[model samples]
Target: MLIGDVARRSGVSARMLRHYESLGLVRPTGRTEAGYRAYSSEDIRRIFHVESLRSLGLSLREVGRALDDPGFRPSELVADLIRQTRERIAGEMELLTRLRRIGAAGPADWEDVLQTVALLQGLGAESAGRRQRAALSSGEESPVPVEALVEAVLNETDPNVAGALRWALERSGEGGLTLLAEGLGSPTAEVRKRAVQAITEIPSGEATTLLRNALTNPDLVVRRYAALALGARGVADAVPTLIDMIVEGANDVDAADALSALAADPASADEIATGLVGRLAHGTVEPSARRRLTQALADIPGTTASRALADLSHDEDRAVALTATYIRKLRDAR
Candidate 1:
């Protein structure tokens, strides 16, 4: 059969058939005299198998591996895939639970209405992104509308929803950031946080002053968000300020997040980890600070990080001890 005939019989698109071929997941039996690829009925059967596995959430790579190995047990692979899917579903459920809590705190006002719309749009965009990522990772043809979907979500609006509509737009990406920056001065802290988060999505020298000013806001949530934005923007200059917060600030979670961001840059990670170790050795670091510092060090993953985590794993604090164990497992995995 030709590609189209195989696609028709298998219920997979020609594009998807080509994708599976590219991944070496399926192959044409031969070529016709005029050079068109010829697929056999068995090839179409394989395509059906591929589609079935994809529907079950197995990446094409996993499917290919199974197809390549005659001794591979399909039941065992499915069981493992199911376990991973369950864990991911659980994590998403937890996030949804938190979102529900946040939503319940507000009444059905213009802001709430906009937020509801934005949330729905954001969910759609995230789902689409996940599908694309999975397909790309598996070398499969993904039927995703990357640009169109992004543009649509970024342009959606609801006048009665107040700032809620803007939330979805901002979360879309850089374009959303532009819309978010326009509403930084809204009376609501949630709005302010969303705006700051959006602006910080892509860091530039131009955003430094805006983020710096936000960092000093009296609202702890706003300040925490600003610190996070600084890290996302990859502003190296923010490292010293972040280190100061981890060493002396009250919001441990924000400090930890900043440290994680700083750790993304090797130079910043080294500086912070070295300073943290000195603080720990001198007995000046608080228990909470020490815990975050250890996590930050573990994230950097080098000689300094290894040494710091090893020391913390044996620390008197139970939290530090647990973090150290987690760090060791990460290192061992590598």
Candidate 2:
């Protein structure tokens, strides 16, 4: 076949075929009497082979090496191609996400688009200061998208940056909660904890619901955060974990305060007292734990906590007895 026929048959343009010849990727095997380039069957087959390799992201030069180099191994080259393809896909996806967020901001013009783009870049910057500034600015006229704030909040490790992200998420509204709820199921415990903390700051009913769901999260920290948030919201369901946190001495003071919030509601007071009383009566609770539990009862309004404090006042551990006695005197004074 002549160059034109070869190009027509193989879908390789004549100019490309000539360029391939110049690079020795594929050369015409013969020429006609008018000195036209002509390709034999084998040459046409090589041309198809080059096109096939190029489709796999092979550079034309790589295609040349692949077809002509006897010592060339395909395994490493194929793996490299896979890596490069994944990187390209990741970059494109990142771009798509940025565009979506910018669109989600409801930008009215190119100026809004540019501002959103700058904020998005800031949110992803390596410097914690930049990320923090981005998070803080997220509440301005055209806020950064909630999705980006959630993404930053979940991945942020620097305490200041994380706090700023949470604040920004709170300002973005409840849309960030969906992403945060998904983070609650993340395999990484820290991410799960961050998800709960982020939700805790959201202060919406949806956030409260997510926190209630997270109360059962397997991670202790996640459970504790959820419990504390739910308790503050006067959710009696958090009473159990608050009691557990008291006994475990894990943020026990905060736990006690949350319990106090629950107890502040007359409906939940006796139930809270009863729950605290049960932990105090457990056989294995140490003197220190018992003391902490005794202190936790100070805010309970009903007879259950008062009576539990009365019984604890004469306990064998003098420290527990004195602590309970002090608490009882205070309750009496109240």
Best by lDDT: 2
Estimate the TM-score of every prediction: 0.39, 0.96
Per-residue lDDT of model 2, residues 1-334, tens digit only: 8988988888888998989999988888898999999889999888889989999999998998988899999999999999999999999999999999999899999999999999999989999999989888876685898888888889999999999988888877788788888999999988998988889998888888888888877888888889988988989999999999989899999999999989988879999999888988899998788889989999888888888889989998899899989988887887
* Cα-based lDDT for every prediction: 0.63, 0.89
Poorly placed runs, candidate 1 (over 4 Å): 1-164, 167-198, 201-205, 216-219, 240-258, 278-289
Give the TM-score comparing model 1 with the true structure, all chains together: 0.39
Estimate, for each residue in 204-232, the C-alpha lDDT of model 1 and write its tens digit. Answer: 55556677777766666666667766766
- CA shift of 11, model 1, Å: 90
Error of 2 at 265 (Å): 2.3
Clashing pairs in 1: 110-161, 114-161, 114-164, 115-164
Kindly report which residue stretches of model 2 are placed more than 4 angstroms away from their true locations once superposed: none
